[model samples]
Target: MSKKTVELSFPKLVLIIATTVFSFTSMSNAFYLMSYAAMPWYIVAGLLFFVPYALIVSEFTGNLGQYSGGLYSWIDHSLSQKAAFLTTFLWYSSYTIWLASLFMKLWIPLSILSFGQDLTTRTASFWHIPQIYWLGLGSCILVLIVVFLINKGFFTISRFMLLGGSLIALLFVVMAVSNLILLVNHHGQLSQPMQQHILLNSPNRDYQGLLGNLGFFIFGITAFGGLDTVASLVDRVGHNKRRFPFAILIAAILITVTYLAGIFLWGASANWAAIFTNQKVSLGNAMYFLMFNLGHQLGGVLGLSSAGTLILSQIFLRLTGLVLFWAYIGLIMTIAYAPLKSIITGTPKNFWPHFLTKENKQGIASHAVLGQGLLIIGLIWLVVFSNAHAVNLYNNLTLMTNVSRSIPYLIVAIAFIQFRKQQHDYQLIAPRYANLASGLVITTILSAISFSIILPLFKAHYLESMLLLIGPMIFSIIAVILYHHFNRQIELS
Candidate 1:
């Protein structure tokens, strides 16, 4: 609220939004997802779903740049205040699951970098506790780290995102080029040559199996999200009215190109079936497999010993894993900060408890950020005590995060249609019906995609599925009760 607070320039705003959109692990998820289908499936999702969805979000953000509450304000203006509260509440709550999964995401890459293999088969001594305990412990540390940074203000957070986003881009470029080199010389551990068939042909999967993989579609769809992360910073973007949409356009193009290149390299390096079978550790396995085998072949060509090549390959894989870890850490930090910012600032003060609305010296939502961190830590502990296997825990949390996050988007879609129908002078270029139809279709697609993830979780294991589903419902019910309580308290005060 200070008059002297620095606003974001065009470039910084672009980096903030870009980092939010270009999640490296999400790209890895896409690579993992592609195991069920051909490259064109990714293209189809990008074109039909991501592109339209990104533009819709951009339009919403840009049009409402003057408002503090990102989606909440937009929906409140267009629809009802109750609708805005529910949308923001759902979106905000999703991060409870997401932060838990983020710890797993970070832990996976760090394990690969340090141990040079999957930790499920290995062990790490941490205060005499098993390695699984360490996973939750480390996640608790990361949650606190994010809470600290959020209290420091988003200016500092934006720098981390910029650095992380750049490193992730470098990771894709290096991997893609390295894989291309190996494929060219026929040097990796591929079962067959890196030919057009593997790159372009559909997998021999049955319909039911493919239906199961629709969960990954939700993963991929959610990856292109976080455009709303910048909703809190809409006013910070210099010349936002013009530059906001332009930035989204550029970010969308960059993400598409990067994903396509990364997917191609991944498919070229490993078999689809193997990737599926090794889904838990597919990314690390694929990266190390390619580098190790390529180094072996190149060493033979250079008249070096096999031992020397193995050393060289290990060095490369370690460095790659390290870079990926840092890059993804940046993403986790942003996810930690942005959604909380959006919901806390977007929701009206009447609905927020006094402590939740309190700000720090840096104008950051200190108490709200701390509360979110506590929720993540509690969730992490719950995971630790439940004694679930790490892989299953990760899979269930991913589904829960996707489903929780998608509900807000459905609300936004309805808001967009309602807003466009009412506001004749809006600057968006699309025809009224075009925007309306896109909202309906995209929301429908996302809803079905969310169901695909939910159904599988229920069928595969009733307990975890109920836990995941009920977590959101429980949170939403609590939130509503609190909203009414806080509103009444505010009115009395």
Candidate 2:
């Protein structure tokens, strides 16, 4: 450690890590989980999956903080390089699924901005073909443009991310204040009153079963999935050995509280009965719909005319759309190349095609980005065109995303246990009991994955459940294929 090396203060590290966790999380997850498991499942998942995973990541911070490749660097050092590649491959693939899904979801906000409500179903198709396929094709074209324009980069993205972060903060604050007012003005009456029994059980009858909507609980866990992104920043923290891990632990707890509060605050305005009875609110447009209702109800609480309330609702809806569109456009581009770059640069040059590995003065690998973008477009076509219904496609994509994202954590958790044992001593957490913290997290995630797979079968979503089980198998097969291909290339070279 050099005295000249600049280091972040504890408070600054907390702020940075908190922002990272929040960036990884989503208000939409709160609404999705609220529809089923609500707060109880949130608490359970937070303790078992969320916090312990943070502990595992924090353990990585002190050891692998010097490396910038995040999970790839950490796992490569602690485990085999091939093991690292496989872990990051799963992570990148999960995120790519999310990227492909966003093409369809971006329509939700576009619909809200154009009309007063979601019109995704109408816009999903034109000339008897899904528009998402067209957008996916367009996305591939844009990636080629990006490949050509990589050096002169289109525009700086920091400003977009800053603006997006601000909008998210404001969105939560506005919701919290409006819901708080409603709670008081309504004389301590909740629109959806919480009963002890209902809080612990699945609230939506459609999702109720012995396993109790395990998918949503896993969805809640997915919100905690991006600790690796935060792990990348440990190098900047002042006391890398101590402060960074503590900051992550603190950020994890704070994020859990925020999500739990957001879920609870929603009940002040959104009645579960009304939303459930009206089966129209699928997972697709639920957030926009709920936020629109929040604005409308808040306008009513302010003693506005029906017309004024409608106008306010429309304004709010459009604003949500604009912000989401702005945020995700930049975010998608960021994730698209960022993860690919990490994976490509972290490994030996022969592991990828030379053209793909070749970087110009701009530090851009054009072919690799194009290759990934082409793959994403293909996946988008398969998912968007395969689903018969717009809502069902979005639901499948979102759930598939949950399963995709969850596997990375399972890989890391199991790896972290091994990573920590090689350490002479543990810092903030003990490694004895075979690193029990990660063990608990690993068990919880595997259970969620297992139950999420088998339970949905009884409900007759046979294909969806089947995918949840086989999704990892598919990813693992791809990882194996890539590994062998690269290994053969190395041998020949």
Candidate 3:
């Protein structure tokens, strides 16, 4: 008997939206913003900054569809191949850093659990054993295995990521509301004045410094960097033109509201000093502390659930990171090989050319996969061996990832401006709103200003920071030189 055949449809566009937003919002940076910056100011800034960027991205995505490589395609079509390559290269580079940072976060909790409270003591038993290093190494190995499994086709992993994200979100809301309820019922008042002057004073007193005390608002904006991931998956989305915009709007509102709730509760429950001094810098930790205190009133079960949720959320985060890393590797392999395959086998560009263009093994060039795989392995190795400076390394990596992701946004802004001017006959299906052009202008200006502001924040000793900024530029230059060199060699051949 012949085996039954089945076709698989691409996942719904809404799922893509949910996953993308979840990925960005769950970053530890978002939590940092709530603890450090002005909560109300952040809410306002998020609306001002993210909304336009979202609209621009949605429109560009709607116009381009799956044929273009989404962001890479938009840049390539609007600018040059070199620019396109740089955009994609930067994007991939940023995700590499993101993967490393997430692994680091997961390792932190594991280390605490393994080493107990003495984990912080430099001369403790755990320190003598260097348990954190071993834990981090083990985590890396686990991640590698997970990535391998994902590559072998674990489609359900995406759904699991979404589910985990939802659970995490629910935990955040519950903890936030619980803290607020407790504060209100106990007649808790702000420990210090909530006035502007009180918030502005810093113990360090470096008021005029270049790194001038970035508040929660700035951090919130920075944390929003990963939202563009949704736009990247536009091609894989169903009803992209209709549903994508709504998804973006909904996600932005949910994230903003969640952040605001956390900040208000934190303010009510703890003073600025307590918030700053808390060693549990992670969002999960803050929520756990709040819930544990509030749970004493509601019985122990709620507190236990909160702790359980945080632990489960970490597992989900690790799994999601692994899946994303492998998916990116797969994408890069496909992109690198498609041209080479066309050249080597002389495959013509026509409809239904060959199975090589359809199936994963056949379509994806092996050499490209090997190259990227080696890079990933090397990065994991660096993370493991550099344990002494791991905290600094992770922070630098996070900043770099943020900067690199911003590059595509900048390029897209330029592209949108150009398309509006040159393509007069091209109709914009969605009518432009009032101040839309102004919004684009402001985004472009802010993009430029923010890059300038953040570049110097990287200290010189942080090699990862230097590499994150310089690596892509170097790769671009090398590509150009090779292109010319190869052309000459071909002439000589």
The residue-by-residue lDDT of candidate 1 on 1-493, one tens digit each, is 2111345566665666676677555555555545424356667667766777677777776677666676788789889877787777777777667777667668766776898765743566667888777777877888888789867876677677777876766766666766676566665444334566544444533322555455555555656677666555665444554567777777778777777766666655556565455545454455555544445544555566878877766766776678778877777777776667667777666457768877888778788888888987887787774655855665665555555676676677777777777654445547755575565546656666456546656468666566656655766786688678767887898
Candidate 2 accuracy as TM-score = 0.83
lDDT of 3 by residue, 1-493 (tens): 0011112223333443544454323333333333334454555556666666666666566556544255666666667655665556566566655654455455443443443222432433355666555655765665565444333321333343344454454555555665566566557654333566544443323322335344333455654565555455443334444455566666666666655555556555445455545666444444334333334433332454756655544443343334433333333322222222222222122211233233343233333334444555566667656754865665655655555556666666676665554453323334465246435536644644454445445544455446556655664565456445545555665
Q: Which residue pairs collide in model 2, if any? A: none
lDDT per model vs. reference: 0.65, 0.67, 0.48
Strongest candidate by lDDT: 2
What's the true lDDT of residue 209 in model 2? 63
- Stretches of candidate 2 above 4 Å error? 1-37, 123-159, 229-247, 381-404, 424-426, 460-462
Worst 10 residues of 2 by lDDT: 150-159
Segments of candidate 3 deviating more than 4 angstroms:
1-19, 22-37, 110-133, 187-218, 239-242, 278-371, 386-402, 421-472, 478-493
| Candidate 1 segments exceeding 4 Å error | 1-15, 28-36, 120-127, 183-216, 238-242, 271-305, 385-401, 424-426, 440-447, 450-473
Q: What is every candidate's alpha-carbon RMSD to the true fold?
A: 4.1, 4.6, 7.5
Worst 10 residues of 3 by lDDT: 1-10
Q: Model 2: per-residue lDDT, tens digit, 1-493?
A: 1111235556555654554456322555455445424677778888887887887787777666666566787788777888888878877877877877665566666667787676555556778877666765665565555445433331332233345555665667777898999999999788877777666566665556645457566666666666675465354343543567777888788778878788888888888777655667666667677778888888999999999998888887787777676556556555665566558766765788788877655456666766776776676667655655754655565566556666767778788777766754446675474467778888987887777777778779898887776676778788889999999989998
